[model samples]
Target: MERLSKATLPAAHTDGVTLPPSGWDTQRTGIVHMGIGAFHRAHQAVYTQDAFAATGDDRWGICGVTQRSDTVKRQLAGQDGLYGVLERAVDHTGVRVVGQVREVLFPAEQNAELMARIVDPATRVITLTVTEKGYRRNGQGGLDLADPAVAADLAGGEPVSAVGRLVRGLQARQRAGAEPITVVCCDNLASNGRVLKRLVDDFCAALGDDDLTAWIASKVTFPCTMVDRIAPATTDADWALGEQILGLHDEGLVTAELFKQWVIEDDFVAERPAWEKAGAQLTDDVEPFENMKLRILNGTHSTLAYAGALRGYPTITRTMADPELAELAAGLITEDVIPVLECPPGEDLPAYGAEVLKRFSNPALAHKTTQIAMDGSQKIPLRLLSTIRDNLAAGRNPAHAITGVAAWMAYVATPEANGLPLPIDDPMADRLAAVRGSKDALGIVENLMGIEDIFGTDLPGNTSVHDQLVDAVTALLP
Candidate 1:
């Protein structure tokens, strides 16, 4: 099979997929995207392609920045920024060749190059899908000055993190007097836009660049977005399937669930892709949707992740296959999580919960428990904590939330119990590792909760919450 590129797209055909036109690359690179991961490829890139196809505006083509690795740059450039996203549904699979990404940049080697694009007047929109830890933010959602990566970034060397790269790019944009740009954050954090703005503000202050800080305050817009799609890390099988189905070998191939949704706060300084035409909702507020997705879908995923990992389930569908575990998640969403969520106007909260659970149980997408469980410290705060906070304030014991928390503590503290060394990947991995040697489950709870960054002061102060978490751990133990 030929490699997917401008040369091969004209002949590409699959049973259930749409291939972009050979002329798609004629579009200019007007969007600068950071953290070019599978999720971004499947979600934002797909939407951008549809927008271009709908309006024939080639100005929104994307230049993706792969933060720390040249792996994506090499793979994507090998295929001329062409990739395939196979939407794996339970009953069938669909494929589409994504072409919106016109270029890929490794900021470490090409910081100056990325800065040039970011500051270019044609680059009207900047978006990000960098995960929670990528922000290098503290518990309060501010830039963590204490972080070593952040500290090194502050020292003005080659950017090692996404936050640093953004800071540097903004600084250069300010120097060049570039026009205002909207920074859309597509992460799952609560109030993501506001959080990113805060981090940028703090970054400017730390550098003592009052002028840049003022410019950002007056000019930049960071729009919060609620993005939903289950795009798992592509396996070797997925790679082969892409070739067999599409008749093209795509090194940048990605796989995701058939379902996808993006809701953005209708706030921007300059033009953006006509994503609304591609089924996105542009609204004045993104909070209701953000809170809904975070606490319900994301919350249930974490529960399923930790619980399923403990029970020796490899994939999310395998985990959800167990009726008890499925009910536990469904019950958590319907009973504990939904009560705290303020569903948007004309939206059915319970129905949404049911749909989320149904998506979780999709057997076609191999959403790994280990992948979902990797960053518990970063995820727990947003996914489970808000509901836990609201439930406690309303005088309700949040046992379901406690189950997710308990599963994490066990997964981290007793790595050997599951027959393999847990791949602890998070900003707080070292701190968690230190407490892994704790003698008892309660000790693990006490020690981890004491880390103000993860648990916050309220959870540790509330003895009842600790007891409930302990009970959850006991229930899960074999």
Candidate 2:
């Protein structure tokens, strides 16, 4: 019944449970990571630890900052920043203890310490996995100065928004004469790094701090990155499984599929981890890889999430087991998305998509459909809308892509599936509440499309797409 920690690690007797290599304790914190969630722990933290183990360089340890709550901090801090990444595949499950996260701090309660870490000269690179809504973007895809949190952050209160914290940290870094740092955005947004830079610029502009803005322009680098890994929300069952395997309670345990990848832009302002040694691809252009993953993997994920949740499939693995739903996902990639994408170098689109489908079918990974279905408004534009827009511009009907969009609409309108309550957990849930009780499919589609933030002005005005959405939503309604 002992909790997994540095002390318990020595008593571990499991055969396949990989421990962090020796000298892990000696590594100093060089990375300040925002949004320290399951995905970051399973993906980037593992890679970072591997980079350290690979080179014996102890300068890449991580200081993980939790954005919204102290739950993750509470989970990992007591464990000495040690956590198990349970890699769940159909045939095999493996656990690896990651130790690169040297410290965990909750920004809400420890903003001053978090800022001090950011100001520290040792913190050379800052990475983020804050989800789409965490950016607090306006409808125009810029920093939402109107947001109360953003306004408060601008007024010199403790920062609430991710951009606010990052910008404030950068301002502090500049004031302390620290070395320039790179900000790597690991979120699932198109042109994520550039988008983050723009958000920071907008924040600076709001403050009218021209000097700090220019300092950022000349000193800091924001690198676009393509990160792929399906780390699901760790359930009680997962914790039990971890205990069964490791003979210890792992509060910070995260479950992911067998696959993991990171493709980062080679642009950095200061020294960075030799991540290429840890199976990360460093390239001059991450756009091709970014777009590929966004469209094929992320787009299909949203589609399956909404559609599968509506059909009462609890998890993505179960959804993929359904013949019809599986085909719908495949068709969305092959018939709609792949046609619009320029294949990345050394990669085949069809093979990549096939692999993505394979990853989704991993039964051991209990990736809940409803979990992925959260924040449809924030996700749709980046995931499904781009494919819809591209196919429409080419004078081709993206029926599968449109189905994905319509599924979101149907999901919003439907309150339950198979007697289970389907909660609409979205930032725009208040605005969507009006359409929830409506029985008219066309009415729902029309109303949702009118929200220019998600669908944009062009899609709503297009009569053809509107008609398609209406029909799709009608068919999807129970």
Candidate 3:
């Protein structure tokens, strides 16, 4: 089969596939995106293309930067930065080819070129989807100056870390007298945009560049966002399915559920795409929406990941098939999370949670429990811990939320679950290794609760929460 590219696009089958707009090639690069992964392809990239199709905007083309590897660069570049989003729903399926990504750069080898794009005055919006660990933040939520990658970047080495690269780009932009820019964070972090701005500020302060810091303060805006889509890791079967539908081999294919959403904080320092024209919500505040998703969808996702993986389920859909696990997910949302959440306007908390559970149960999306189970240390703090802390403050015992944390403790301590090796894929795996040395459930819980980064300084001293965790971990241990 001919590869999916501009050359073959003319002859490709489009009966059920959505093609890019006719003049998509005329669009110029105006957005520089970090961490060009599957989720971004299926979520933000799709929205970007829609924005172009809606307004005929020619300045919002994307230059996608691959942070950790050249794999995505090769995959996308091989096909002229073209990729397919295979949207799967229970009753329907569709495919859309995205052409908004005009360029792909691997930062390791293309640092200069990537920096050039960031410094380009045409580029007014910089978006990031780098996962939590990519930030290299210290436990106190500031730039970790001791991080080797951060330190190397600070010492004038080739930029490596996400924050490092971003700060360096801002420095170049300032020197070049570039226009003001907006930095939108599309990650799963709490107050992601605010958090990123602080990291950038911290990076600048570390370098003792008060001038650059002041320039950034005056020129840059980081807007919080709530991005949602169930884009799972595309497998061989998915690629083959795309080939069957398009009659072209697409190496850059991503699979996702049909539902998608982007809620921005209505804050930007420069011009941006007409995203609201493409079904995005641009509001004055993103906190209510952000907190709702974090505590409900993300929090329950972590719960299901740990508990489901331990139950020998490979995928979240499969886990949801189990009545007990499904009930646990529903109960966690209704009981613990909903009570603490202030419902976003025009949204019903219970109904939204039900929709989330329905999305998870979509059989076409093979969102792996093990995949969601990765990076538990970074996720637990925002997802489960916050709910726990809130419930504690309200004088309520959040058992279900406590169980989620306990499940993570057991997951970290146990090497295998249901005869399969459960890999500890956390950045803090070395620190978490201490829990494995404990003799019993209480010992493991105690050790993990001591990790100030996740539990915080206050949660560790709460005897009620600690006792609950001990009992929950004891029950969960295999």
**Which candidate wins on lDDT?**
2
lDDT of 3 by residue, 1-478 (tens): 9999999998778777989997887799999999999999999989999999999989999999999889888898889888899989999777799999999999899899988999999999999999989899899999899999999999997799999999999999999999999999999988899999999999899899999999999999999999999899999999988999888999999999999989999899899999999999998889899999988999899898888887778899998999988998998899999998888888899999999999989999899888998999999999999999889888898999999999888888888878756788988999998877354988898888888888879998999999999998888877
* Location of the lowest summed lDDT over 10 successive residues in candidate 3: 434-443
Candidate number with the higher lDDT (1 or 3): 3
lDDT of 2 by residue, 438-470 (tens): 779989998999898888779889888899999
lDDT of 3 at 454: 83
Cα-based lDDT for every prediction = 0.87, 0.92, 0.91
lDDT by residue for model 1 (1-478), tens: 7888887877677577688854587899999999999999999999999999988988999999998689999998878888999889879786798888999998879988999999899999999988988898877778999888889988988778777888888888889988999999998888899989999888888889999899988889998899999999999999888888888888998999989999999999888899999999999999999889999999999999888887878889999999989988988997798877798876899999989988998888898888999888999988988899999998887888888888888777766444634567877888899766454777777888888988888899898889887777767753
Higher lDDT: candidate 2 or 3? 2
List the candidates' TM-scores in order.
0.97, 0.98, 0.98
Error of 1 at 259 (Å): 0.6
Alpha carbon lDDT at 242, candidate 3 = 90
Which whole-number lDDT from 0 to 100 does residue 13 have in model 3? 85
* lDDT score, candidate 2: 0.92
Residue 290 deviation, candidate 1, in Å? 0.5
